[model samples]
Structure formats: C-alpha cells, structure tokens
Target: MAEARSFLQRNRIHRALSRSNLLLGGDRELVLLTALAAAILIFVVLTVYSALLGISIWIGILGALRWMAKADPLMRQVYTRHINYRHHYAPTSSPWRRP
Candidate 1:
C-alpha cells in the first residue's frame, strides 16, 4: 500500500536556488561595500557636509544599482568575464578560423 506524503516530507528549496540571487537589489559585495563607504563618510568624516555628501551618494548610487539589477541581475558576472576579452577579434571566414 502506498502511503500519503506529508507536507513535512516534501523538499523545499530556498529562494536562492530559484532566483537570480540578488541582495539589496544589486551585487551582494557591492551593496555591502557601499553601505560601509556611506557609513564612513557620514560618521567617520566628522562633518555635517560629509554626512550630507554620504547620504546623497548613497541614495543616488543605490537607486542606480537597483535599476541596473532589475535590468540585468547577472551584470557583474558578465562584466568580469568581458574584461579579459581582446579588443579585436579576427574577422575571418569560417574556413580560415579553423585550426
């Protein structure tokens, strides 16, 4: 006789398993670094001007990052791979391209 499966027996994958894995609407490392930088500028700099600057920078950049993340969640990975590419690729026919 087959037994009915209970809800507790079912496997539940986390959000990380299915999603593009965003953190604070951008790359995890980038968001954390931005927070640290803003905190330092706002508090460690020890001036009202610096605090204002930090707040503005944080807001502006975070907004941009959110837009970017929405546009392409894998942008950071794509960019890093692109950085090693040569400036020019051979414009040869398929016949010439073969080793």
Candidate 2:
C-alpha cells in the first residue's frame, strides 16, 4: 500500500515538473501572464457571480481567450501554407519587359 502511494505521489510530481519545464521553455512571459489571468478569473467566478448574465459573459470571454491561445499554432500553420502556395504558384512573368 505504501509503495503504491509513494509511486503515485512521485508520478504526480514528475508530471508537474515536466509541465513546468515545457512552459518555461516557451515564451515564459506570455505563459506567466496567461496563468495570472486564469487564476484571477477563477477567483472572480467563485466569489462574484451574483447574476447569471454577467457571469456567463465573463466565462465566455475567458473561454475565447483560451481558445485563441490554443489556436495560435493552427493560425501559424495556415500562414505557412499560404506562403508556400505563393512561392510555388506565383506568376513567373517579369513586370519589366526586355527592350
């Protein structure tokens, strides 16, 4: 029993350390700011949600922000495809004709 518990605890710690490392390896400032915003939003949702409409709007905004962050890679992929297509398919004609 004790051995199993120790293994679980170690696994959790390892996972957390790996996640932290991954975040730190990227844009650390953006990660930290997003984390701060998420924490604040959670606190507000827990303590300040008196009306349904306002709470729903705040939650929607938070969801949209999260979606945008996750969608960045997809956006980059689309942009890359656009550039590749332009390079491969652009017209070869010269604007200045030879005399």
Candidate 3:
C-alpha cells in the first residue's frame, strides 16, 4: 500500500527494527541462563530433602534446623539450652549469668 511505503520511507522503519534486533540479541541467552540456574537449585533441594525423608532423620532435625535458620544460630543455641518452664514459679535468673 502507498501508506505503508510512505511510513517506511519517512521513518526508515526496517532499518530501525534491524538495529534494535542487534541491540536485543543477548536477551534470549540471559533468559535461558536464569531458567537453568533456577532448575539446578530446585533439583538440589529436592534431592537432599528426599534423601533425608528416606533415612527418617529429617523429622528430628527439621524443627531445630528450621528455628535456627530463622534466627541467629548462637541465640537459638542459648535459648534452647537454658530456658526452663519449671523455674517459672521460682525466682527468675538471667540465663546469661551464673547462678
């Protein structure tokens, strides 16, 4: 059509598209790399958890590991070792200090 030809001539549209294509050439490779990394991470996690479940040790470890992962590892260790409900009725003492 005449309109199409005129628009192309005025804008040099084909040349612009080709230039843009050159600039955008690496987009596909980036997308492929991201997908590959995600897949690898997913596979590693699944394999480790499956192994843990098969051995039946994961249940004992899951609670402590999850809590430690959520908070500071040192603080979790301190809290678990020293906190006592039996002492609630007795005089309170600082867990960080010697009795």
Candidate 4:
C-alpha cells in the first residue's frame, strides 16, 4: 500500500510544484475568511431554528436520533467500502522477527 501511495504521490509532482505560486495574494486570505463567515452564518441559522423548536432535553435527544437514523445507511456504506478497500491492500506481517 505504501509503495502504491508513493506512485500516486509521484503522479502529483506537477501539483506540488505549483504550490509556490501565490497568485491570490491577500485575496486568498479573504477567500478563506469569507468561507469561514459563510459557515458561521449557516451554523447560526441552524442554531436559531433549533432554539425556536424548543430548549429541552427531550427535543435534543429526538433531534439527535432523527439525524442518526437519516445518516446511518450512507455512513454504513462509506465505512464498509473503506474497510474492504483497506483489507484488500493491507500489508501482511513477515514471519521473520525484526530487531
């Protein structure tokens, strides 16, 4: 797996070479700040909705369970795919002991 990964890294040499070019200057920093602000805005909206729904332990528990049920199948599929891929390429231990 490590050997295969090294080959993938070698294929990305051109992408690595372009990292030195700072074409955005301060605009890059502004872009990052804008993205963060957008995330905070969405989070605040969700929080406001949740608060309006109710401030209660029962509501929180139900919301959590609902989200888990909604997300579980997709999460399970992703996890299974990752496990199968890893097992297919995982390195086997050598019989000889190393110092």
Per-residue alpha-carbon lDDT of model 1 for 13-81, expressed as tens digits?
Answer: 998688886777887777778988999888888898998999899888888888889999888889987
lDDT by residue (8-95, candidate 4, tens digit) is 4335457756542221232233334544555565557687664444335334544553464455524434666998898565364764
lDDT of 1 at 71: 91
Q: Which candidate is the best by lDDT?
A: 1
Report the number of clashing residue pairs per model. 0, 0, 0, 0
- List the candidates ranked by TM-score, beginning with the highest: 1, 2, 3, 4
Q: Per-candidate TM vs. native? A: 0.69, 0.25, 0.24, 0.23
- List where candidate 2 sits over 4 angstroms from the true fold: 1-22, 47-99
Model 2 / residue 5 / CA error / Å: 61
**35-58: candidate 2 lDDT, tens digit per residue:** 666566666776555345455654
TM match of model 3 to true structure: 0.24
lDDT of each: 0.82, 0.52, 0.46, 0.48
Error of 2 at 81 (Å): 24
Give the range where candidate 4 is weakest over 10 consecutive residues by summed lDDT.
Answer: 20-29
- lDDT for residue 26 in candidate 3, whole number 0-100: 28
- Give the poorly placed runs of model 3, Cα more than 4 Å off: 1-12, 19-26, 47-99
RMSD of 3: 20.8
